[model samples]
Target: MDEVARAFLLPSALIWCLAGWFAASRRGLSSSPVFAGCWLLALAGNLSLILAAELLVFYFGFALMTFAAYGLVVHQGSPQALNAGRWYLFMMFLGELCLFTAVALLAVAAGAATALGLASYHGLTLGLFAVGFAIKLGLVGVHTWLPRAHPVAPVPASAVLSGVMIKTGILGWWRVSEPHGPLLSDWGPWLMFLGIVTVFYGIASGLNSREPKTVLAWSSVSQMGLAALLAGLALTSPGAGHLAWLGIAWLVLHHGLAKAALFLGAGLFQDSQGKARGWIGLLLCLPALALAGAPFTSGWFAKAALDAAVIEAGQGAWLPWLLTAGAVGTTLLMARFLHSLWVTPEADGLPTRGPWLPWGFSIVCVLALPWTAWVPEHVRDMANGPLALLSALWPVVLGLALYMALFTRPATAIRWPWRPRAFGPRAAIPALLPGLVHVERRMHRWSVVGTLFMFVIALLLAALSLRISGPVA
Candidate 1:
């Protein structure tokens, strides 16, 4: 696990450094001291997670990272940034409460704060950890903070927030919970169920959003769902759980780097002019397609591992098929992101060197990472297999087909290779925008969010109860 964390940490550090540079280069933000402070804070958070040997060490790291991200989110100090920061901080503190309690409970039960010691406790403690971490994972119902925060934050901040910060939740779970030894709780199926919900819901929400960053934010929600599914499957199958945990780690690394590339690329695309616009668009699509788990990409490699783990676990027939379907949503989301990028006006000035270096590095990393020696031989083999390649190809094909069919209107007279226009006249902006925003606003209210937090806790308790009670007599 530490090995896997190290692999993840390396790219994260590189990206974080790039993020600070990018933030510093932004026009109005150049003089702000928060960028450097937040960068260090984020750095400290990353180190704490990577080097943590004890539960307290890991939790402190997680907390530092979480709060430090708050500074980045509110860097702009606009109404939107302030609002997003408020919601983000609120959710962060609430999640911290759940996390602190769960960690303390594990420490008390096991008499030590090490992962090995904490694993001895029953699944109920795992459940607490899940509730706490799921906030960061942006798992359904509790995921409102993500879309709000990611879009409003500056590009560099958004990059790290989505790419690196979010994965800490899964890392926290890896540190404190044992999925491979014994099932502490029966939350595996529930985790899977919620994950599936998050996948579809994220697509739905993204389709409705106008901001390109918001669309990407929702896409993160969906990808995190895939990670959660991997985690859930791991928890349920002692035989395959270790393999599944590897898949989880790989998935986060794969998603983080690729998503960071796309976010940074989106910013670049927005800022490019003339030929640079077309070139940046092409660059942007590479990571976007990579994100769809297209063949030969890192997503393909990581997803193959996940598929193998699921099969090895004997989870069910439907899950793999459903996961394939998820690729379709991702395709649509990426397509929308691209289209949004296309229509937006390019920035007037020449592109900055700051984002280019890291963005290019990220793209290079995305393409090259899977082929490195560190990847397992089996994963490499699977990624190269004809059957796996074809399976990966189909979803992207289907998603493109679906995008053309849904977004374009059929010409009155059909011709050979009939081309369709992009987007329905009515579908240009989501019809549900006002309502979704309104709901999110209400959720931001202290009274309402407080209730929602309690509701999440109640749901956690109920899930634990159902697991403990088994079938009613």
Candidate 2:
């Protein structure tokens, strides 16, 4: 690795180490060993990427990170957790397979042994990379795993998974786009269309979900869709690449901090106070509002930058409309989450306040930092303008309106289902016995072999297809 790469390695490695240590020290020996191992593996894999001088090493690093995350998801030992973890692993492995095929094709076309650095790939290779990375980014159909996994993992794990891990796909795409910059324009519209679909799909499903964590998971899906839209705009107009990069970076920072806070808070509320704490419920609204791009929040700056960039690219007309609709949908989801919390019965006694420093720091970071760093100078003058403020306000208003219209009556009438219904215990049995046992006994033994076979089949098909069609005309 070069000096620049080494510089990047140091910070990432240190952060990984700190995260692992923090997680380990929090609960000590009582902590889940499987979870600790997963964190360790992810740290090692991400650090290895910095040292990876070739494609094979990079591929290995990526795979290690992914598999480790999957383990973390299932670490809770619940049936729900395990099912989610299985889905997460299956999707990740599939994404990796697609990526490997694309990398191999790039190597063949370039007549090079290593297409590791990404600057080596050309037009068709870039397209493949885009699709592969999009899968990881949770674009449309490939996004099914995200909603399942994020809600089931331990809180801290969920925070990092949503905050940092998914952005690796965005980082990968950024790296791949470096060389064939202008050529990517051809793929721009398709990416935009896919991104728009993902954004709305997430919002729609999130609104339908009853669980707070599940709604948050779907929110991540929607936020990622916005990121993809910015990336698509960047691809369409190479001159706007810097803006796109900034927007993406802003997204990573904004969503990471905000979602982490929300997930961690959710976990704390559920564990200690039993989700009935009124104040805690109200506090939850902050992150959700920030996520919806409410006025003066970090999300506002991020959304503004993205909106402006798309407009400047002359893709303005429909893209803005789509984004506005997405914002409305997000608002509705947040309102639903808040209403759920409000109606749920409080625990019998007053809740004890835990250490405030950690929670306060996380919330402040989510609320403040992204705007300070990412709001560009060009847009500075427009930051507090009427249009910008109005753009931010309307969504919250629409969300509130929808919430009152649809959920208010039901929320008021319904009582909390505090105790699990009798059928719930029985429901748990079938999910546990067959699925977990099958995975442990027969399935675990054969997974590696089966995965290898599937990988081979996928590669063969890609090769056969390539031979038949010389290249894109």
The TM-score leader among the candidates is 1
Global lDDT of model 2: 0.67
What local distance difference test score does each model get? 0.77, 0.67
- Per-residue CA lDDT of candidate 1, range 1-473, in tens? 45756866876777787666666666656777767788688879877777787778888988998999898899878999999898899888878877776676556655666563334444455656777799998988788899999888888889888988888887776765553346433767777788888887788778767688998999999999988887777767778787888888778778888888888888777877888789888888888988888988888887788888988999789888898889987988888788777889867667554357767877888888777876777677667768888999999999888766555445223342433333442243244233554565566577887897787678556544542322111
Name the runs in model 1 displaced over 4 angstroms.
24-30, 108-124, 348-354, 408-448, 456-473
Score every model by TM-score. Answer: 0.87, 0.80
Q: Distance (Å) between predicted and true CA of 57, model 2? A: 4.0
Off by over 4 Å in 2: 1-30, 47-54, 107-124, 274-276, 341-356, 370-374, 410-460, 464-473
Considering summed lDDT, which 10 consecutive residues are worst modelled in model 1? 464-473
Instruction: Return the clash pairs for model 1, or none.
Output: 123-184
Q: Highest lDDT among the candidates is held by which one? A: 1
